[model samples]
Target: MRTFDTDALECLAAIVEEGGFERAAVRLSVTQSAVSQRLRALEAQVGTVLLVRSRPVKPTSAGRLLIKHAMQMRLLRADLETDLQDLTPGAGALREEDRISIAINADSIATWALPALGPLVSEGLPLEIITDDQDFTHEWLREGQVLGCVTTLKQALRGCKVMPLGAMHYVAVASPAYAAENCPKGLTTHNFRQIPFIAFNRKDDLQTEFVSRACGLRRVALIQRFVPSVEGQVRAVLSGWGASVLPTLQVQSRLDSGELVNLAPDVTLPVNLYWHCWNLDSVVIDRLTAALTTAATQALKVPG
Candidate 1:
């Protein structure tokens, strides 16, 4: 059977998380030389260099693979410890609570996911949330940087299971005044170059994709400022900053009250999202999955 030096593997994970050997040493409460010795011993035993030893240090493919293993082990170990504590009648709580790192999209974080996860977090299960675009969260999942992720990637990884969580529907919208003033001609291929819009970030092509698919305008002019947040994006629209595609959940009330105008009232964009997590026998993971599934049912559009 292949064996591992658990401590050394953990040391490597610390380096990856803390971003440097010095910080890792501080985190592990060990001397820098001791940390170096453990890493060297680990590399020697595996006959491979697990860390790049760069300024902040990076993991090679092999290193990433090992780091993945180490992280999974940590989650399992945390579960085991929790179960053991439960069996002991008078066991005190852990000195430091265990944490499960999860990846979710920025939109989901700002919208429904956090409110759903609030109860669990309030109960003391430390949650480390990594927010990215829904389409890209799978990369974090594949790297084992997170225990699970909410993503648009529907296929399961080799060692993970995928669960469809329905979709987050989006609508093209603008403030009633902005639509009247800028889009006096309304959204059209001819006016595509003239209307202003907001982009969350460079990678955020949510506005771009909406125009092409909904209006059949592939090339567009970005004549607006970047607002890199959900509330900010909505506020920008409300303050007549620009027209942008927003999640249906965010603007539904505004649409009803005339605070926002749905430019493409009949058009909607649905991003089908899924949950991906390690295929393992873990109560903690199972509980979290159940909670997320329940939340998604309430927050997301059900598949017909």
Candidate 2:
């Protein structure tokens, strides 16, 4: 039997994680040709293709399986080191590069995600976070860019575990002045059709979805403003550019201060989020998951 070598698997994992041979080489501190040679050797040993070799190299099913094992090996190595250091009275503690990288939506990151991971970071464990739109974060998981993700999808990725994170409540809000001026009769789906909407970017559909659900309509007014960042989105709403669907956590202070008013108090947008990750037995990953689950339960309202 041809057993897979941990070093070769590590090289393949790095290549998939970095998305290219040159970048992977830089990360591994080796020449690009050396990285390529390692991958070729691994493929020959397994008698199967592992990477797609495209612009951003994608992993084949076989590659993903090995990458998952490689991540597990990293965690095992960390645990071994920690166990070895237990012999010393207090030998400075074990520091390892074993990380649980997560790709999560911007809204979740801006709201409850980081707080959920606070316990892990406080314990000195490494975590890597990649923020993108909720609709797109799954691609990172599929490509092996991250070991885990907080995604909007309910289904688990192949060879991965999925757990419900909870729903985030959003409300359409606008500056007091904007509401007073454009929203004479108070904010309603009927009047919302005419008012401009503020969005995070072209990918943002919060306003559109809200308007559609509220008015039994589809698209919102085309006269829209784009603010790419979470802070910028709030600022745009505050600057009277247009109304926006703001997360409760992000606008709680402003809402309490009377700076921003709810457009429709009865209408609420609840986005359900889920935690997805590789199914691996890793102490560090298990610890992080437990902490995240605890924090999320406290921070979010559990669905009935």
* Residue lDDT tens for model 1, 1-304: 6677888887887888789989889988899898899999988988889888888888878778888888787787667756776797445442232357889988888778888888867655667898888878889888877889999887899799989998899998898889998886567776756777877777787778888777776576557668878889999889987898889988899899999988887688888889999999997788789988889999999754
Query: What lDDT score belongs to each candidate, Candidate 1 first?
Result: 0.82, 0.78
Report, for all candidates in order, the number of backbone clashes: 0, 0
Off by over 4 Å in 1: 31-33, 54-56, 85-98, 217-225
Summing lDDT over every window of 10 consecutive residues in candidate 1, give the lowest-scoring window: 89-98
Clashes of 2: 0
Error of 1 at 108 (Å): 0.9
Q: Over 4 Å off in model 2, which ranges?
A: 81-97, 142-144, 155-159, 201-203, 218-226
lDDT of 2 at 52: 95
